[model samples]
Target: MVPVAPTVLFLINEHIATEALLGEAFTDHGFDVETFEVVPAERAEDPAGHVTFPDPAGYDVIAPLGATWPVYEPALRDTWVGDEMQLMRDAAAGGTALLGVCFGGQLLAQTFGGSVARSPRPEIGWCEVTSDRSDIVPGGPWFQWHFDRWSLPPGATELARTADSSQAFVLGRALALQFHPEVDTELLKVWLAADSNGEALQAGITHDELLTRTEELAVDTAARVRRLVAGFLTYLAGQPRPS
Candidate 1:
């Protein structure tokens, strides 16, 4: 019998920040991908519109992408954040693979009893990362743009880190990354044109420089992201399901 293509459910918080490179990587590995926007475009300006998450167990893999909204806001937790966290917890417990990026990583950490808070120093643009398991999580000047960091969930193994924060961790079938291996120059442009431009400038990074750097690193970055996704799939396949 022919096997069905594995499906990846992407929880995209903003229209501008869809799967990008990582989605391509998944497709290359024979997975079908679909996106569910938590914050719909019609309701982009309204906080009330951001209060829903789909059932994560339906998909073979769950990928929660970056978000402009802070994951630790009390108001959010009282509404959608709590529900989303619960969904992630359930998904992990059910043996669904999770690939969390930036804000999504914070959500995964929080779901596993870890915590997210404002970092003393926000990491923006390209920064160097140190990785103990370079085969799975490579050391790099990975793309990072966030004002917060996670403390990591209990029993999660730290795979990589930078001076300012923990960069990557693994717990069960989940792999959480503080840096954005998924972003491409096009996605970065959308972010720069939106609210993140000021933060980029504040970090002493300019749009032209960022775009130029992205152009220069495109080939290598794509290769790296592909490797990470391939490694994640391998890891997920080897994990024993909970009885």
Candidate 2:
């Protein structure tokens, strides 16, 4: 039988550049991808509040890209959180892969009964991640930009960590990453230009610092992210179809 094209849903809560880069990456991996810009029309309003989509059962994978706070704040935290959680659980239950990046990772943790709250110390810029599961996230430095942290969900395995945060987690075929291994220079520039790095960025971190780290290891880091995503897809394909 000819293999069916696996449909992948790319959630662009905000950060259009990131949405494009991630979609391109997955497309290169041989999956059909679609993107949605879910920013609410009104400020301080829920973006998803005004949008609608069918069940996640239609997709072979659900990937929520990292975004600026205005995108995830009042909107995602309120109106969209539950629905996204349901979508995540449904995808996992249906044996479809689920990969969450940054705030996307927080969403995944919460879906699995974990808590998402401000970290003791907000991690900004590039930081070294020690992989607890080397098979998933190979140890090295991964880019981080967030003021929050998450508790690993029940039955979830932590893939990586830093001095201040649990950087990555995995549950079933689901994978959650607090850092942006998928971050490319263009997106970085746009994100910096918008001054959306949150409290961490405001704490005196410099763009030069981030550029230096990412530039020094861009090739290697991309390779690690590839390994991580490939591992998740392998797990997803191995799962039995739901009865």
Candidate 3:
């Protein structure tokens, strides 16, 4: 009998950037991917209402995606966000590999006794990241749309950084990135439409410009994500399992 592919559970915080590009990469690498929308559209009126999460121990991998809400908000910490953090901590303790992106990365840091706070300047749009380990986590003009940043977790190795913030880090079987490598043009359009706070406008970001940039970097971004996922899998393989 053919063995089942390793399962990856994506903890999607909102509808903005669903696992569009990254999900495809996981499937290509022989893993079955499933997403749990923490805040479904039906619950849009009350985002934190009646949320539920799956058992992290059941999956071989867990990836928490980005969210609109800030990770340090007291109200969120009192609700589903707190619950999600506990889930992440438990998953990590159980040796499940984690891939955190954007807000998700912040979650990983916060759960593992690191700190997350407002950046000196919010990083939006494409920006180049510097990495010593370029072959694994390449330096890039990568997509970034976040207002907050995280300090490295205890015992985590800093892999990449930009002038403004630490861009990526790894600990055990987990890897976290401050940028949205999972995003595609379609996802960017949704994010632009949902910008109720005029964040993009204030940052001088227009839909046409973002869309055009995404179109221009489509091939490169996809290739980068593929390499990132491949590197993550390699990293996970090298981690010692809890005995």
What are the runs in model 1 whose C-alpha is more than 4 Å off? Answer: 48-52
Judge candidate 1 against the unseen true structure and give its global Cα lDDT, from 0 to 1.
Answer: 0.86
The C-alpha RMSD of each candidate to the native structure, in angstroms, is: 1.5, 2.8, 1.4
lDDT of 1 by residue, 41-114 (tens): 77666544335567776788999898877888887776777878888888888888898999999989988989
Worst 10 residues of 3 by lDDT: 43-52
lDDT of each: 0.86, 0.73, 0.87
RMSD of 2: 2.8
Q: Which prediction has more favorable lDDT, 1 or 2? A: 1
| Model with the higher lDDT, candidate 2 or 3 | 3
Q: Would you list the rank order by TM-score, best first?
A: 3, 1, 2
In the range 87-158, model 2's lDDT, one tens digit per residue, is: 777777777778898888888988888888777777777788888777667778777777788888989888
- In candidate 3, list every pair of residues with a backbone clash: none
Candidate 2 local Cα displacement, residue 191, angstroms: 0.5
Ranking by lDDT: 3, 1, 2
- 34 Cα displacement, candidate 3 (Å): 0.5
TM-scores for all candidates: the values are 0.95, 0.86, 0.95
